[model samples]
Target: MSCTETGAALHVEGLCWGPRPGLTLVDDIGFSIEAGSRLAILGPNGAGRTSLLRCLYRAVQPNAGRIAIDGVDLWSVSAREAAKTIAVVLQEMPGDFPFSVRDVVMMGRIPRREGLSGWSELDRERVAHALSHLDLAHLAGRQFATLSGGEKQRVLIARALAQEPRIIILDEPTNHLDIRHQLEILDLLRTLKLTIVSTLHDINLAAEFATDVAIITEGRLTAFGSPDAVLSPRELSAAFGVTATVHGAAASGGTRFSFSLPRQGSLS
Candidate 1:
């Protein structure tokens, strides 16, 4: 429950990844995330959002460019050191994991330097707080496989929270949830004072939750700025090839958007 009060800053420069030059999935991407800021990456399918994320978390090495975490080059750090600093919640989970929800959450503590002391009282307290924070206390004893998709997603997020990471990277954290749970999860993220970088399918959710937004398409970053500045009708039409109407978020004061397909034979 107790994380570093200040999150680490992230910087990326000319980040590219693929088996070879011509086949790059993420090309010439560059961005910076100030400490404790939330950034949402939006793009159409196969635009390489996930590929870019994989580079940040070091799932795959970038063929070119640099990734720096709080002024430290991420690739220069040991994998264990990086794990302690960054926690990620991906879209998929191991369906047949033979572990209880609490057990799975406890795994997050493995990255910390406990020095052979084994699971400590502090660890248990953190796990408990994460469970309650995610509204999973009653399901603590339930098997992970028995939970619904929404519940499973929440469990993954709880696990990430228990890690007490400086930065949390999520890939479509709202993928499986109903509207209520989606809002609930995003709300919980909003309360955390950590750096959050996520790939979101819903432009509305990004506008509501993110302080900054990056719009990428065809493996390139097209727009990056405040959600209000980046999520415009022009960017929407260019990135998605659809006609959209942009509006204010009403009482929430965030940006809102709606879209419609192009007219017949209008597709370029």
Candidate 2:
């Protein structure tokens, strides 16, 4: 698959993973995202959305298949090397850290720091830029644990930005935020230059935010393509086991969706 001319290209083929024998959580998933694109993975609970992301971000090694970043096998590179190109924002935040916000963001530079030399001018500059870009500069001195959910999420994203990676991977980025914060975070993601890969439960948000969408269910990829093609009523109904309807065109402002559970003992 061809990605955009900017950012990094990511390709996964025949990806499969599971904890041990006789069980598989991710099965033969394959897709590619070009640079500067957002790919949203959607599925019901326990449908392996998180497992797929874990494989992509190297949090867990796939039992089979290959992941290539910018045309190089991900496994061929060291963890430090991979960290230079891929940054990750997880769903959970650290319970408590005595460090201030600035200190938290500075940690992103750890991958780039040379042995025994400590942080350089570039590190400081990137951290400052990230803080300003995320509008967290005003809160830089605040204790991390004391911030609101939205602020904490932004801080985590700022930390990812400070890494200066070509691709950023997140798992359920909007999970715990309120409606306003959800939109804020998604809007922030749209402005970023990096390739974005994330899992979201909200189908409408995925439709609005993603350049491409992949639907996974039962550890398999059910659909993959532009949202217009992949997010049809049929696909949604099958993947989510709901009666799905699409309203409005993507070009006419935005596409919206509504879903209801299928009637018991009745096939429509």
Lowest lDDT 10-mer window, candidate 2?
1-10
- Measure candidate 2: CA RMSD: 2.5
Off by over 4 Å in 2: 1-6, 266-268
lDDT of 2 by residue, 1-268 (tens): 1222246889999999999988999999999989889999999999999999899888999999999988899998888888888889999778688989999999998988999897899899999999999999999999999999999999999998998888999999999899999999999989898899999999999988999999999999999999999999999998888989888887895689999888986334
Per-candidate local distance difference test: 0.89, 0.91
Output the number of the TM-score-best candidate.
2
The residue-by-residue lDDT of candidate 1 on 203-266, one tens digit each, is 8889889998999898999999897788888888889999888776644784578999989776
Q: Against the hidden true structure, what lDDT does model 1 obtain?
A: 0.89
